[model samples]
Target: MLPGPRRLKRPSDFGATVRRGSRAATPTVVVHVRRTIDQDPPDFTRVGFVVSKKVGNAVTRNRVKRRLRHFAGDLDAQFNTDVVVRALPAAALEPQRVRDDLEDAWARAFARAAAC
Candidate 1:
């Protein structure tokens, strides 16, 4: 699990990440990268998950959230950014694919964030 401070818990934070953040995506998942103004730890990067109802029922959505929360450890970036990983409907069929897609998404997200 992400440490409490490293998690993006509020709705507004998620909204900002999606709205103003740089984005990178595959067919299965999208990674949003937003620079944060919060004055907490400098290198800490916050993360949130958005597994919409289109992905599955509650049980399945929770499962995907858990999986995403686990693998997203590797996504600990050096900047003070808010990162959101949004799942697409096709992710219901395969969980491992999400990790792979997240890896690709993270690379693209960093590139895009740099440009921003």
Candidate 2:
């Protein structure tokens, strides 16, 4: 589970990050990354996951979300950033692929941000 401070819980936070953040997509996931300047110490990045019904039924969606939370927890070392991860339907079908895609998409998201 992600620490409380590292989780993006508000709808406003999700909207703002997804709207303004740089985006990168892999076969199983899409990641939106935004650099933030508001947190007091900003030692850790905030993250949220979106696993819609399109991904699966309730059980599958929860499983995918749990996987994403685990992945996001591992990536929280990034400071002063907000990340939203959206799972593709393929994510429910390929658990291993989700991990690789999450890392790849995040790197690509930052690369895209840098290029902009």
Candidate 3:
């Protein structure tokens, strides 16, 4: 069979780097992050996405995943930490709405991480 897409092989490469090394959340999504303190100089970090069927049908789920991936890629430089974003059912409301919520969630997560 043919090989899968290159992007699928490197999931971690698509995530952002928040200021802190832990996870946080908001109303729209749940961020789960684990820092690698063991490594002398950490290697590439890892990230994953989790969206439930409640979000919508297969197509809708794929669309949401794509949006999250895009957002993660775009925000990679803004943060300096690893994150796994779990999309909430509310995220299926609208593209822009979901984006807005995700942004808000990220901000909250960053702030919480900073506090710790």
Candidate 4:
């Protein structure tokens, strides 16, 4: 599980990331990353996961979320950014593949952020 301070908790936080974050997708998941300029500390990054009913029942969704959180755990503290990872149905059956995809997505997201 993501630590409390590093997890996105509110509906608005998800909405903001969805609305404004730069996005990248793999076959099994979509990623949205939003960087903020005035965020305090300047090195905290928060990560959230979204796995809907389309992905699975509660048990499956929670499993996928746990896998995603585990992957996000490896990320170093970066500039203030909020990232949302949305899992697709296929993700329910593939943990390692999702992790590989997430690694690619993170690379792309950071590259995009650096351009601006």
lDDT of 3 by residue, 24-113 (tens): 666567765544344462344345577889889999888888888777655432334456678877777756676666677666666766
lDDT by residue for model 2 over 1-116, one digit each (tens)? 79888888999989998999999999999999888867463677888989999998999999999999988777633446888999999999989889888999988897776666
State which candidate, 3 or 4, has the greater lDDT. Answer: 4
Expressed as tens digits, the lDDT of each residue in 1-116 for candidate 4 is 57888888778888988898888888888888888655453357888889999987999899998889988889653467888888988898776699888888877876676566
List the candidates ranked by TM-score, beginning with the highest: 1, 2, 4, 3
Give the clashing residue pairs of candidate 2, or none: none
TM-score, structure 1 vs. true: 0.91
lDDT of 1 by residue, 14-55 (tens): 999899999998978999998877666447788999999999
lDDT of each: 0.86, 0.86, 0.60, 0.81
Residue 56 displacement in candidate 4 (angstroms): 0.7
TM-scores vs. true structure, each candidate: 0.91, 0.89, 0.65, 0.89
Ranking by lDDT: 2, 1, 4, 3
Output the better candidate (1/2) by TM-score: 1
* Model 3: residues with Cα > 4 Å off, grouped in runs: 1-23, 40-45, 76-80
Minimum summed lDDT over a 10-residue window in model 3 is located at 1-10
List CA RMSD, all candidates. 1.6, 1.8, 6.2, 1.8
Better candidate by lDDT, 1 or 3: 1
